[model samples]
Target: MPDFLLSQLLVSVTLIIECGAMQLKNKNYILAALSVSCFFNGFHYLLLEQPTAGYIFLFSSIRFLISIKWKFQWISAASLCVSLIITVSTYIGILSIIGFFATIFITIGSFSKNDRFLRLMMITGGSVWLLHNLLLWTPVGILVEVIFVGSSCIGYYRYYVAHKPSEP
Candidate 1:
């Protein structure tokens, strides 16, 4: 199979896993699914020759694992630190910084207790990712970001808006 097809297949699976992650009521389960998604995403980036992005996500999975035990503040701090290390070491250009910030935003969202804040950060991160992928001319990356944004909105509605008690 072509590299694009293989990479896209991985992304397709990641999208499905992300959907499951978003719909769950249990935070642990959501994080577990997110961990899996991140792993697959790392491979997808590798296929795209964005090894720095791949390394960032692969390293991020460790933070997610730590998130299971540590507090949100710790996770966010770890994420930021990792981003700085990756970005500084790689130093591709301005575009590389976008991935770093996006990683931090995603880490914050993943650990946040607030449902709305989680989705908002997800949308924000996804938008930045969309721009990055577009700049890289990565079709699969572009598709994943677009779908992720739409899925996040749906997840937010289902988990928050739809479940809210009707006002008196």
Candidate 2:
């Protein structure tokens, strides 16, 4: 299989299945899909010498359903920590580390109510984009990447701070 095929299939299947199950009472499927997708994506990336940031995004989502839950927080923290380490490794010239950490952190922050994580994401994103520029010797990709990261970070902030809770 192609390196990305498994992860791509997992994500597509997840989107399809989840959308079909929107009215069901059991939400375990959503969590399970996310977890499995993250696990596969992360594991695949690791196998292919890629950053495990996709795992961070999917695995760290328990914080959304509840606040400070044990499994969710620990997993999120672990993924976040891994992502950060990957970020550091990326800067240090790890050829395999593809800055997935920044992407995953932003994904997680975008899903949560945590402004702190959002800010952390923006900083991490900007920092990594700058590092990419430093390494690539080109400014072309930097603007697009920075804007993407910035936009996602800002969207999360705006949503969390400006929106009313649907319930609870």
Candidate 3:
């Protein structure tokens, strides 16, 4: 199969997996699903020749899985530091900056115990990634980010907003 075709296939799988994560109310399950999605997305970016995004996505897969079992502040700090190192080492151009910031937001959110905050950070990171995808002209990537943001928002609303106690 052609690289482009394979890249599309990878990202499409990522999109499906990530979309499933949005509906998950359990933090650990969400993290697990995201880890799988990130793994696939890493390969997709690599095939597109975007090393910065690719490496960050690959690292994120491990980070998300680790966060599911450990919510230590040190872990979050180390993840951020490692993300910076990856971004710097794989520096492609201005686009890499976007992926780095997205990774930072995602890493912090992933380490938190609050599911609402996690979804919020996912939305923020996904929005930033939207720009990166646009710049790269990856239609599947752009679609994934858009769906990620929308699904995250819906999840947030369903769990946080809709269920909030009525202040009397």
RMSD of each: 2.8, 8.2, 2.1
Worst 10 residues of 1 by lDDT: 159-168
lDDT of 1 at 123: 80
| True-vs-predicted CA distance for residue 56, candidate 2, Å | 4.4
Residue pairs of candidate 2 with colliding backbone atoms: none
Task: Give Cα-based local distance difference scores for all models.
Answer: 0.77, 0.44, 0.91
Q: Write model 1 residue lDDT over 1-168, tens digit each, in one string.
A: 887788888877777777657667666676777788888888887787777777887877777777766656876786778778887887677667888878878888777776578777888888888888888777767877888887777877876788773421
Worst 10 residues of 3 by lDDT: 159-168
Candidate 2 worst ten-residue window by lDDT: 18-27
Count: clashes, candidate 2: 0
- Runs in model 2 deviating more than 4 A are 1-29, 44-49, 52-79, 90-168
| Candidate 2 lDDT over residue span 1-168, tens digit each | 874555455444433433332222233443343344334434533433334333333344443333223335555566566656646654434322545545555445434444445445644654664454345433333443454445445544554456653531
Error of 1 at 58 (Å): 0.7
TM-score-better candidate, 2 vs 3:
3
